[model samples]
Target: MSKGKEMEGEDEIEDLCRNDSKHGSKKRLVARVGGSSSGEPQDADYSVVASLSDELALILARVPRSEYWKFTFVNKRFFSLLKSGELYKIRKEIGVKECSVFMLASGETSWWAFDRQFRSCKKLPILPSDVCFQTGDKESVCAGTHLIVSGKEFEGVVIWRYEFAANKWFKGPNMINPRCLFASATCGTCAFVAGGIGMETNWKVLNSAEKYNPETKSWEPLPGMHRKRKLCSGFCMDNKFYVIGGTNEEGKGLTCAEVFDEKKNDWDLIPNMLKDSPVSTSQSPPLVAVVNNELYSLEASSNELKVYLKGSNSWKNLGPVPVKADVARGWGVAFKSLGDELLVIGASSNSYAGHGMTICTCFPKPQADELHWRSLDKGCTNQMSHFILNCSVMGA
Candidate 1:
C-alpha cells in the first residue's frame, strides 16, 4: 500500500480507539521535551503503531481468537497493538467477535487462555483469593468482559472476577446471597445462577437464584427454581437460562430441568429432561454446552455426546467424545461452546495418566449420519495437567 492508504488506516484506528487518558498526553509531552525543540515530529513519533495490509486486515478481522498469539511474531507493531488491547477495541467497535477459551487445570496455580484453534495460549494472572477458596470446588461463568468464579473461602463463599480489558483479577462485588455448587449461565452481558447447597444451621440445598450484571458489579436475586438442587449445569439457549440434571435436597438425582423466563420473572420446570441418561452419586454435573441455540451434553457413563431434542425434551446421541469422560465420571473435563463448534478438553482414554490433555472440536449437525471430531495440534495446552477443574468461554 502507498503512504496515503497506510495513513488512512492508522487514522481510522485512532478515530475508533479510546484515547482520553491524561497519562498519554503527559507521556507525549515528556517525549517532546526530551527530543527536538521544534517538536513538529512529535505526532509522527507518537503515532499509534499497528501494521496490517488490506488483505491481512480482512483475514485477521474475525478469526479464531487462538490465532492472536501469532500476531506477536508478525512484527513489533502488531505485538504492541495486541498487548495494549487496541486491536480488540478496534474489533469491538466494528462489531466483530469470536470466542476464546479460559480454563483452569488440576494442579495449576493460574488459569490459561487458549485461542479457538489452540494455536496460541497465554497464562492469565493468578487468582488472589485465599487458599480455602483456591482449594475448594468452584463455578465459573462469563458476562460481558468479566469472568466470575465463585468458591468457598475461609470467610465463607466468595466471588472473584477477572477483568479482560485490564488483564487483572478483582475480588467481588459478591453475590447477594453467597453460595457454592450453584448452576450458572451467561447471556450477552448478564449471568444467572441458581440452585446450590447453602449453609446456615445445617447443610441444606437451596432453590434460590440470582442474576449478575458485570456493569453493576453486583448480583440481584431472582425467583427460585422449582426444586432445590446442587451439582447441576447451566446454559443459555434461545435467550433463556436453563439448569439441568442436579441432585435434589434428599440427595436424589433429578431428571427435571428449570428454565427462567425473564419476561415472566418466573421459572418453568421441565420434567424428564435427562431421564434417559444415568445419574450416579459419584457423577459430576452434566457436561453441557450450547452452540447456535442448540443444547448438547456429554454422557459421562458412556462417553457419548448427546443433543437435546428441545421440542420433545429428549436427547439423541451424536456419538462419543475423544476423552476418558467415564474415568472420573466427567469431573475433570472442559466442555464449552466455542463460537460455532463444541470444544472438549480432557485426557483421552488411552493417554497416560498425568500426561497432556487432548483438545477436540466439532461442528455438530443434529442427527447427522455421523458426527465428526477433529483434534487440533496442541500448542502450550500440554503445559498443564490433563484434568480440567474449571472452564469458561468468553467472546473477544
Candidate 2:
C-alpha cells in the first residue's frame, strides 16, 4: 500500500504496521505526562502502551471542546493513531464534529450533531447560514443515527434530518406550524417535537406536537398540549417523557407540566413546577440532572438550582448557580457529577454583542454552600454563545 493512501478505512491503519516499515516495526508509542518521546516516552513506556488501548478509550470519553483537542497534539504517533477511522468511532463517542453555535439573522440558534457534541459553527457544509436550533430545553438531546432539526432563521420554521454515518443531510417531515424555542427529544428509533412559537411577524404560540418513526420515516401527529406554549422545556426520564415550564398565549409563565407514557400512548399531567422565583420566561429550559438519588435542576436565568427527592416528593433549593444570570449565556451550563460532587459548567458572552465566550465550572470548593464555578477558558467562544447551548456527558 502507498504511504500516502496506505489503507482502506481503519483496517488500512492496522495493515499499515504489516505493510510499511516507516511506522516502525519494533518501536512502540508511549504516553507521557509532559510531552512526547523520540518514539513513546521512556519513563512510562511499558505502562503507557500496556494500557494504551484503555487509556485511549478514557481520553475518548472526555468532551471534545477543550479536553479532547488537547490529546491531538500530544505526540506524532498518537496523532497518527487517532487519525485512523477507528478513532472516528471514538470521535463519534465523544460527539466530535457535531453542532456548534452558528449565528443567524434571527436571534442565534444552535445546530447540533447526532450526539449533540463537536459543532462546526463557521462553515456548515449543508446547513444554510439561516438555519439554527436548540435541543430539548432542559438538556440537549442526541439526534438519532437519523436526526431532525426545526425552527427558522428569519421567516419560518422547517425541520431537517442529519445522517451521521453517511455525512449527509436530508429534509424531514414538517411540523404543523413554524416555531422556534420549542422542545425536541429522541428515544429509541423515534423523535418527538413540540411546543414553540411562530416565526412570522404575528409571533403566535404553538400547542401542537408530532412524532417521527424511523421504521416508517413518517410523522404522526400527537395530541396538542392542553396549553398553547412557547419557550417550553422537555426531556425523557425513566423511559417516560416530560414537558415542563413555558408561558401560554396569554404570556403568563406556566407551572403546569405533563408526561407521556409510550406503552399507554397518552399524556398525563404531572406535578406542578416547584414554586420558585416567578418562572423565568427569558430563561431557556431549566438545566436538569439526577444526582445523589434526587432529580436536580438549575435555572441559570433565575440563578437557582433545586433538587427534587422522589422518595419524599419534595423540593429543596440547593445553591444558586454560582454565576449571575447575566453572565450565563445559552449553552452555559454543562452538568456532570465527579464522584459525590455535581459539576456545573457555565459560560456566557463577555458582552451582549457576543464578542467572546467565558466558561466556568461550578463544584463544591471543599465546603458546602461555597460553590466555585471557575472559568476554564475564554478564547473558544463560537457563534452559539448568543443563544441557548448544552454540554453532554461523554461515555467511552
| Model 2: per-residue Cα lDDT over 1-396, one tens digit each | 475553342454344334323534212322221233233433333233432342334244334533434554554434444443244344443333433222222233433322222222222245542423332222223343454555443444566655433445566556555567776655434667678776653778887777777546677788777777777766655666667777888988887777777788777875566455357666655566543334566666556666665555456666666444445322444544332345454434345543344434444432244355555433334434433344433222
Best by lDDT: 1
Q: Model 1: per-residue lDDT, tens digit, 1-396?
A: 899998886675444332412223323322322343332322222223233433233335455556666665645544544555555554554467877788998888889887778787788998988889888888899987779998888887778999875689989887877777788988877889988888542568988999998767888999988899988889999889999988998899999999998989999989899899888768999999998899999998888999989888788988888888877888899888998999998987657562568889999988775588999888787667879999998886
Q: What residue pairs are clashing in model 1? A: 66-115, 66-116
Tell me the deviation in Å of residue 361 in model 2.
5.8
- For every model shown, the clashing-pair count is 2, 10
lDDT of each: 0.78, 0.50
Query: Worst lDDT window (10 residues) for model 2?
Result: 25-34
TM-score of each: 0.81, 0.56
Error of 2 at 196 (Å): 2.5
